[model samples]
Target: MPRRLISSGSTFEREIGYSRAVVDGEWIFVSGTTGFDYGKMTISDDLLEQAEQCFRNIQAALTEAGGNLEDIVRVTYILPDAGDFPKCWPIFRKYLGDVRPAAMMISAGLSDPRMRIEIQVTARRSSGS
Candidate 1:
């Protein structure tokens, strides 16, 4: 199969020259998605809300790339404040506890101060499972 690029219609994607997700063969790689609702381009100040929105954005990209959260093999979480990460656990567990993909969390600076959380994931389509 040929490589495919997926877009979430975020203006930043066009301005930054990157795809929201990329599909190649059986693998799908979703970019680091923030809490911003792309349609409204707004983010929440609460960490839990932001975390939920991040997963929603990632799910949208994964769905467009021909897979779902169950297919995810790895996940990377970026948070500007390390202290805020624990507060997001309940929300994270809601979406990923069952799937339990390999995950890592890092404290880092974000492009936007309002962005409390960003998530990126990689998935592989199962064959005959």
Candidate 2:
């Protein structure tokens, strides 16, 4: 099967030498995505807002890969502040409550100080989906 690459048109993808997501057959591997609104090249200061944006970015990449949030089988969350993780539960549930994919969170520094959270996901497209 042929592999496919997806891009969000974020400058970071080109500058850092990475695609937003890679599709290998039915599997899609999304890169660690932050809250930046790629169209405006801007990010929010609020953690919740940033968290929401992260999903939006991830959703966009998945859509381009011919999958949706429900296809996500695994997800990884990275945050600069561990304390902020709990604050994002509602937002997470709002997006993935029903799907409830496997998930993990880690505390670590991000490339940009402005970035509070980063989300990466792995999705598999169901046959005929």
Candidate 3:
């Protein structure tokens, strides 16, 4: 199957020249997604809120790619402050408790200081799904 590109209509994707997610056959690669709501381009100041929004954004990309959270096989989390990570565990469990994809977390800086967390995921569509 031909590769397909998905967009969330975020200006950043256009400005940066990258798709929100790319669907190639059964595999989907979702780009690192921040908390800024694509519709309003606004992000909350709270760390938990940002983490929740990150999952929501990722879910949108995965859904557009013909999959859901359950399809995610891997997840990578990037946080500017490593100390804030423990505070986000509840939010993480809320979204991925059952899916439980292989995951990792890294401390890193983001292009925008407003961004506290960014999530990137890899998912595979089940056959006959």
Candidate 4:
């Protein structure tokens, strides 16, 4: 199967020779997407807004792979401050609720200090191999 490159204007992807996501057959791998608009890395301090942007970024990549949020089977959330879980979890659950894709959360440093959260995801397209 020919692999299709996914780009959301993420700086890391352009700087490191990588893609925001890769689509091969039915599988989609979304690189760690930070909380920012496409092509911009610097983010605001609001944890909830940042989380929402991260999810949106992942969704955009998934869509490019001929998939959607409903197709996501797994997700990994990385947060710089775990304490913000309370504020961020609600938004996450609100968006991914019934889909109930497998998820993991880890608190760690981000590439940019201003970024508080990053999300990586996996999805399978219905028509995909």
What TM-score does each of the candidates earn? 0.96, 0.97, 0.97, 0.91
Candidate 1: the clashing residue pairs are none
Which digits, one per residue and each the tens of the lDDT, describe model 1 over residues 1-129? Answer: 999999999999999999999999999999999999999998888888888888899888888887888899999999999998888889888998999999999999999999988999999978632
Better of 2 and 3 by TM-score: 2
lDDT of 4 by residue, 25-109 (tens): 8889988888888755667678888888888888888887888888888989888889876778788888799889999999999
| Candidate 3 lDDT, 6-74, residue by residue in tens | 999999999999999999999999999999999998999998998988999999998888998989899
Tens digits of lDDT, candidate 2, 4-118: 9999999999999999999999999999999999989999999999999999999999999999999999999999999999999999999999999999999999999999999
Better of 1 and 2 by lDDT: 2
Report model 1's TM-score to 2 decimal places: 0.96
Model 4: lDDT equals: 0.84
Please give the CA lDDT of all the candidate structures. Answer: 0.91, 0.95, 0.93, 0.84
Q: How many angstroms is residue 63 displaced in model 4 relative to the true structure, after the best TM-score fit?
A: 1.0
- Could you say which candidate leads in lDDT? 2
From the highest lDDT down, the ranking of the candidates is 2, 3, 1, 4
Model 2, C-alpha of 63: deviation from truth (Å): 0.6
Model 4 regions lying over 4 Å from their true place: 40-42, 127-129
Error of 1 at 24 (Å): 0.6
lDDT of 2 at 94: 98
Model 4: clashing residue pairs?
A: none
